[model samples]
Target: MPIRLTILIVAGSALAGCSWAPPVQESRTGQIITAPANPSGVQRGPHGETSPVLLTARKMIGVDYAYGGHSPETGFDCSGLVYYAHKVNGIQVPRTAAAQFRFADPVPRDALRPGDLMFFRTSGRKISHVGIYLGPGRFVHAPGTGKHVTVADHRSTYWRARFAGAGRVKTNYPLRTSAVRNPR
Candidate 1:
């Protein structure tokens, strides 16, 4: 067999038993292995108003999970929640999880900041579910029909098994400001 092919087979063998090792983590030597920056190459944030995006999403906590829903009156699906949140905040994103995954900048699980998106392959090989990271390993998502918008433990068994990588949106989110007004 060729040397390259032989090496590939040996490497595969070494990892055949263990399943997942997390998308990223701090090495014991105190080094980060996968702290990639935003693929868009832009660093300024809150350009799309992250706080409004999250606030809008929080207001939707009890909204039903409708397959094609996009509004409070209609409820929301997974991607729909992301869409509505961004859209209402003056930012726009694709309407489906698969499309959203393809368009956003890929992120390591450990480098996730609040307002970053977490994806999942709940049903098939393709990305299916989407949620917004709310820091501290929590995310908000519209689970499914008959389910309401809810907070989920990102590290739980069900989610970890289905855990896909994270994505960073290059939006002007949370609306940062340099001015503070004193209360009269």
Candidate 2:
């Protein structure tokens, strides 16, 4: 074969290979990772308002768990953390864990999403503990005195055995609305 013809064939083959590359598919769940087309939409971080609440909660890890404390610079208890998180996110929530659990819609364990609150009976008296679900069976919370806010596996023996229930705060935006005509 002529040298010029060989070079042309090689160049054509490279371009053909590039055109045949497979399209990427994103996995919304599980460990086989894939990148989404709109990276800003699903990427986890503080960049977007929806997931910033979780980022703020995560930033408080290692802060002391002070009873009745609500300020991030000071410390936080279970309810205080929940209250502060929602408050900063522009959502109004009850100050105590029990009350917070009451006003939201109940979510099944299997259906829990990030930002959903999980309640537990640490004292065997009431919903004394709570955590923010971080998806894939993990949650963040201020455990108790001598412990700091942290993330833990939901399937852990400690949390799994004491699981009370889960709740989702209703956003101000209604699911549906009726149309109305304007008066002239």
Number of the top TM-score candidate: 2
Per-residue lDDT over 61-108 for candidate 1, one digit per residue giving the tens place of the 0 to 100 score:
766789989876677999999989988877778888877787677888
Writing each residue's lDDT as its tens digit, candidate 2 over 52-126 gives 566557656666789997866667999899878877777767788877777667889987767788989888757
Best by lDDT: 1
**22 in model 1: Cα distance from truth in Å?**
30
Report the Cα lDDT for residue 170, model 2: 66
lDDT of 2 at 3: 51
Give the 10-residue window scoring lowest on summed lDDT in candidate 2. Answer: 175-184
lDDT value, candidate 2, whole model: 0.70
